[model samples]
Target: MKGQDYYIPAAAMAIALVFKLPALRNNWRDPLLRSVCVLLTLAGAVFTFAAPPTIDAVNEWTGIPNFSAPLVYCLMTAFSASCLVLMFNWRGGPAEEIRATSRRWISGYATVVVAIMVLFALGDAPEQRLRDFDTFYANTPYIRVMIAAYLLAHNVAAMTMVAMCWRWSLQVRGWLRGGLVIIVAGYAFSLTYDATKMSAVVARWLGHNLDDLSTYVAPPLASAGALISAVGFVLPLVCQRTSDSWQTWSTYRRLGTLWHEVQSTAPAGTPGVRMSWWSPAEIRVIQRESDIHDGFLRLGPCFDRRHRDAAYEEALAHGADEETARAVADAAMVAAAVRTSAADPEGTAAEDPGEGERVLIMADGPRDLVRISHALRHSPVVAATRRRATTADG
Candidate 1:
């Protein structure tokens, strides 16, 4: 039975471990700490599993029995208590005061837990033993206090953790915010069941009745808690991966829509017809390139930042000096800006391409052609610009 109680926590621990690895971030949001606590809870489960069966069958309390139940559960309590301590500590950032305070809190809790465990051990006496067959109970005074203190300590700690997570959810996000709460709630449920069982056992002993309510109440709650905590731990991993995928897809979709719009705007064979005006070239140009001129062609018009960077890198790598690279980069920027700006005012006299005395912004030069590769790599404007310049020059 105790084995069953610890198993859920064990499962929670295992799930939390996935977040602990260094490949993942070690922030408070991370589940590594939670995982450690669950594992410790699992350790508690082990002792409960081992001792409960023997106690349950002992109908008479007269034997000089080993009082390992509370002692072992105390160990579990320490693990659970330690978990709450860490969760509380996360509220403190880099400030020394917060850190010192958290440390002090942990130290105090630790002392209390150790002292309580020892008290339970020391307080047990042969005369105080409930030695009647067909009856089970804690008929001793100190035993009662030790159990109450331990449970009370755990309850206080677990609920505080839940409240902390709840408070953080006001501004927090992802798994840390949600998972912390779920884990806290689960532990809370399990602990409450435990405390309630302790209360019931006391009542049953006083009345000389043997009703194992703790056994009945605990396992199911622990299982439910295990499931909740497991979800809490794994949900963040799923959310993150999904978010990245959504962002990537959104970017590609935007780029695709832009490509279609540019294609439709170009006039047939006009190079950069209305649709193609802002687009890049399709055919790559092969002119004098630098030392590694054989690199991939990324044709772009005189615009497009990414395309321009690629062109700039290519130009420098292919042996073009800094002066040449700067000139090409600057010239492309000016042309792209000019084209975009010119298109803004429809019906304005300044936009008429055939108007006399206009330079026509010829993109036929060798410098322009080299940079076109960069534009083509980034946007559709490169191909359109190339076709326009080729037609105009011819």
Candidate 2:
């Protein structure tokens, strides 16, 4: 493979390792996270060791020509085994069930590793073959069998990961689903790597040469698969935080107008004089909601139940759905509250759940608040109510 080809997986592996370091350090007890970290580290090593320059250097340092060939292949086999083990962990079941299944896969791949070593010992390959290793050793004694065994092991692992990822993704959603699909796509490229290498080996057996396919086609496929698989494993954890930040920021932005309108009437409701520029979006949303409710409480003396009822019926008459009408009514009430607070900021009256008003239990949570915020932005009924309140005050 070209130097550039090796650089891609190397870069990907480095990024994955850096991204996962914090999780690995803090959550070492998590089996799945540990497995993913090991998988990425091994994948990077495989890419680095498989590069032609590294192979040549290792051969010269060890004073054994072609020694790095089997060493690199062995590392590749270990990388594949780690990948399957990671996948098994990801498809979680009961602890005992997973342990038993994982042990079996470990034993099976262990046997493959031993067989590869034995075959390499008995084989005769004096030349250092980098890109065309499969075809170069196709007719060599036990080396031929060893090459085939390694390829077989790789293909099996790749296929198993592809199938498992596909099935697992179907059962999940959001970032996890997208991550698994990307993993499946990676292994699909692995299948291509296996196909091209095997075809070249078969061609050698038939006394013909397809060295170009193994040399030119297979390494790129392997490199791409490793990079993608590593990314797939990391995507969910990274994306979860990213998606949350986006949603939180969106909520903070969307509620800005409503928060500003209410806070103007109840300056005392604001708990702080200075807002932190880098405060989390969730914190900002909670603070804003608190200010809104505090302002609403201050307007209790001016809250006219009849006005809210009229707004609700008007929203319904305008063909708003039940939920929409309720939201519009809530927005109108808040708008009126803002006006009332402005008219008499010092009015002292216990906040009453107006007649026909839904007594929103604490369990109702943020749904009602969100609905009212949405209506404040787009509900025509809220605008009409504000106009009526203004005219009445005048």
Q: Which stretches of candidate 1 lie over 4 Å from their true place?
A: 2-12, 15-67, 89-92, 125-135, 202-210, 230-383, 386-394
For each candidate in the order shown, give its overall lDDT on alpha carbons: 0.48, 0.79
Candidate 1 lDDT over 1-394, as tens digits, reads: 4544544455545555554543345454544444444444554353344344544433135244545455444564665555555555445465566556557766867776777767666765443222121114355666656656665666666666567667776677765677666776776776666665565666666774444555555546645554564455446545665676665444333333223323333335643323233332221112122111211111122234543454456557767677556544433433343354335324253344443322222334434433433334453333444344344433
Model 2, backbone clash pairs (residues 3+ apart or across chains), number? 0
Candidate number of the best lDDT: 2
Residue-level lDDT for 107 in candidate 1: 82
lDDT of 2 by residue, 47-107 (tens): 9888888888888998776778778778888888888878778778898887788788878
- Residue 314, model 2: lDDT of 94
